[model samples]
Target: MTLRRGACLLMGFALLGGCNLSLPLQGRAPQEVSHRTSSFEPLAEAPQSEILSNLIQRRSVIAEDSALGDVARVALSSGARPSEAKLRTAKLRAEAENKNWLPTIGPVVSLTSLGDVLASLVVDQVLFDHGRKKAEREFAWADVEVAAVTLSQDMNDRVFTALSLYVTALRGQEKAQVGDRAMRQMRAFNRIVAGRVTGGVSNLGDLRMVEDKTQSILSMRDTAKDEATAALAELEAMTGTRFDGQPVAALAGLHDDGGAPLEVLKADAEAKRSVAQATIQRASLLPGLNASGTVSNSGSSATLEASGETGIGLGTGGKLKAIEASKETARRQVAEAQEDAARKQSRLEQRIASQQRQQAEAQRLAQQGQETYRLFQAQFRAGQRSVLEVVNVYEQSVRRALEGVDAKYDVILAQLELARDMGLLADGDAI
Candidate 1:
């Protein structure tokens, strides 16, 4: 019975050992993992600074500038005119017809088939028509303001998008540099291991292990390169130019210390939009005014060849009664636009705040990771820790560093977005 119990215990211990061996390596390998490392050719001697320089130069803060130009051209062609011009035209037209009730004396003329002729001149204008002219002028003015606001909004969007792309590219380039350095370190380690194995100081196993680790690093480097390439491509697409992989200018002293409050910006946009609506409403209540005049002369004689006589008169016409109905519709539309813009601004602010909080947390975690790595490094050098332990700590350090970089980038981007929302972006502030 005693022997059987001992045998059973031994078997159980063996099973447990097998289980541990089969389990995944959750911490680090007993030896460094070896794999093919990614390779990159040296940059060509050609000067590629122009490629990125052109990209920055091509980006525009005012997207609506072009659109506004187009709109202005169309408006001019269609006779929509600026607010000043429209007001002037309306005033002149109103003045010409303001004397509708006034009576005027002039020569009169008439002609008959029996060779009789009569001549006369007459004048007339609107006596009164409520507040038609005033309303029309107000509506025209509102339209002008609406166009200007829309242009400003478009400009803000364009500038923000360009800057976002620029920042992304810059971050990508930094990551690629890190990957390159890692690759170089792995290569050097591989060479050392190879020499040790040849001298019989280390066995084939150690060499193979180092080779595998190198390859893994290479793969990571490849991924980083791809990421950088994609970022550059996106930047190029935005700026409508080629990028030769030049670094973007560092963002320093770019943030505004006195950024306009979100509430203030929202209020301003709403106010301008409201004014546009009011103008439209007011314009609808006004009536149109116009005047016409005609005159003619004829030859006359005592015989059948006598020429006919001519007469002249003046009159004016336009529709003012129906405009008031249209004005009501326009007022409702303006209200809707103002509400929509406010909602968008609110959502943006919330997102930025959330990202900022997350970044702060990440930064704390990274610091902790750094301290832990230092402790592990000291322990490893003293021969009290295995190679695997040291590698695990190094991996942790890399991860923490990446997280910190990402968090920093996120914060910068959020600030940029806020600036854009407030319409504070400028042409010279690319990335």
Candidate 2:
């Protein structure tokens, strides 16, 4: 009967205690992602300003129905993306931390001096924690933001890789086509040299040299075909979709001028996380007040307690100052990250511009070489140029054509890299 009365009394106190606390015991539930982004004052303006808008507008670069988009969809859906899973976990943890200020209930057991068992139900509520709970909540929120940035980076990387491989396969195919045309022209030259030798106008050595040159062109074409086949196989394995014909559309000019790059966002999130953690640690060094109610079989009791280190030594001040310094360090890291991102963006922009120029120059040179080869062919027929000189001019023209093909693909590859860095390869919602 006494134990039953004590249990009832404990239940009554638990309810009363829950009602008396100053802090919010029942915290708010998890909100939408936009709310999460806007709630943090430091990073609040960054997302809403223009980066997110630009991300939405950039979706046209890789439309949902395009081949690049198909590969992205397949790779993202292949399995649970690790960064996205981490983001989910961080949100769950934040949800759990939200209610950390609430009172806790647990069973407590002990032995009496006479070796008897003493058990009770204890309810513990932190009455004063020096803002430890608040700092912990902030830490959890920052973690979610960090995870969010990481997820975006991962998705962009995956899409960039898939798209770059597709471009590579196409590049190899185009080069092989150029090689095939060169081989056909070389075979024609070989036929002429053979007829000249049979008519006693050209020696056997000339015929052999033309035949060898024809063989070399065939080998180059075969090598290029082998490269295309390998790249296509790899792309198929990665995306689980085999491509029959890849598009050669330009991927440049897709990057917008305004946007916070992923690196800056990641750095800011991590800085907030670091500072919050340091606050939590500093709070741990100070005393905390807790209120508790206990109910035993015999009776019920209530107590208020202060828990922490009993003494502060000489080094304690230095430790506290060091923690403050660590916070400053975190802030400085964010600044450094912003600068680095700006430099890299500038460098990529410059590289893209330079490659575009190189592509144009290569195209011009290739055309000029073709015209030169035609004049050399005319001279050979007029007996002004040797068979070897005509053949050499043809090879030079083919070489220029191959260089032009490389420059074209190189520009596309660099553009894709820039897009990946800017987090423009995938949509924000998709991440």
Candidate 3:
């Protein structure tokens, strides 16, 4: 009977030793994609839209910026954001690590089928950890707040990126328009040169001169087309919105009246979410109670054990002052960030104002040049000017016109950037 009991005990331990008890470490959820939706670029069949109205029709650039930013925010929360899944997983790991603080309990029972069988339940509740366990929980929560701040910053960066691409798309359209106008002027000059060559008034070399200019304009056209395509593709990739036409960025200023400043959003979450949570770590420095008990019965025999632990010894209560200091640092950092953002925003606004002033000057020059071209056209028909002279004025006018277009869009780009910085670039607020 003694040998049988010893064999059973050894076999039970061996079997228990072989039992798999570790956590099921899942392979990191296959590389998280930042794009909220599967990218499918369909065959583009819509007519090319060149007016700013295109932005107004489907969605404003600012609106799209805000929407995509929100989408990315959701992705961050769901472990789908770029590099965010790991951070989110870390928070989960922190919480899982905290489970170690809970007491480990075990059962002490006789392996028998008879009445009055011996049994005991032993529990070790490691409580009153002088704020250690509480601090750990708060720290885990703080990690989540850190993740939120990271996501908000990431979303802020993406908003600027998307808005910049929209501006690029707008500028590309301007280039395409200028290229188109230049090509038309080149064609007219080539026709005049061909007439002179046929009439023996000009040589083949003169005709080739106009043709060379035509070729240069053609190259510019091709370059513009390529750039437009690239900008559209990049926009589509980032925001999942097809850019088939010119992006019209209507002036959308940031009217952030009620929303919290971006700096506050950038702070630790507990501090942002609750005032009491700011002192959470300090509260953790106090000892917490850990209560444990054991009870056993075998026929007429009975036993009981009850005990508890209070935090003591070694570096306890020393870091509470440091934790309090960090809370103050967080607040100061928030204020500094807000001020920096404000300064940057002011710089963009000043630049936009400057661009607007330059746009007006360039438009005036373009108008005067256009009038000169018109008068030169009449003079050529009336034999007061040559085709070559007329073409020179026409080229100069076109250059001025292109300059005006560029200047106008530069202001628009600056305005969009300012709105992005303010974190309120929405579709509905018109310039």
Please tell me which predicted candidate would have the highest TM-score against the true structure.
2
lDDT of candidate 2 over 53-134, digit per residue (tens): 4333434256677666676677656635777678778877877876676678898899999999999888787767777887
> What's each prediction's clash count?
31, 0, 11
| Tens digit of per-residue lDDT, candidate 1, span 314-413 | 3111222234344455456556655765677677667667766777777787788778867876886696765445555655655666666676677667
Candidate 3 backbone clash number: 11
For all candidates in order, the CA lDDT equals: 0.47, 0.77, 0.57
Cα lDDT for residue 316, candidate 3: 52
Q: Which segments of candidate 2 are over 4 A away from where they belong?
A: 1-60, 113-117, 309-311
- In order of appearance, the predictions have TM-scores of 0.50, 0.85, 0.61
Off by over 4 Å in 3: 1-141, 152-167, 197-213, 236-241, 246-249, 260-264, 268-289, 296-327, 425-431
How far off is residue 107 in model 1, in Å?
Answer: 20
Better model by lDDT: candidate 1 vs candidate 2: 2
Cα deviation of 67, candidate 3, in Å: 13
With candidate 2 superimposed using the best TM-score fit, by how many Å does residue 225's alpha carbon deviate from the native?
1.7
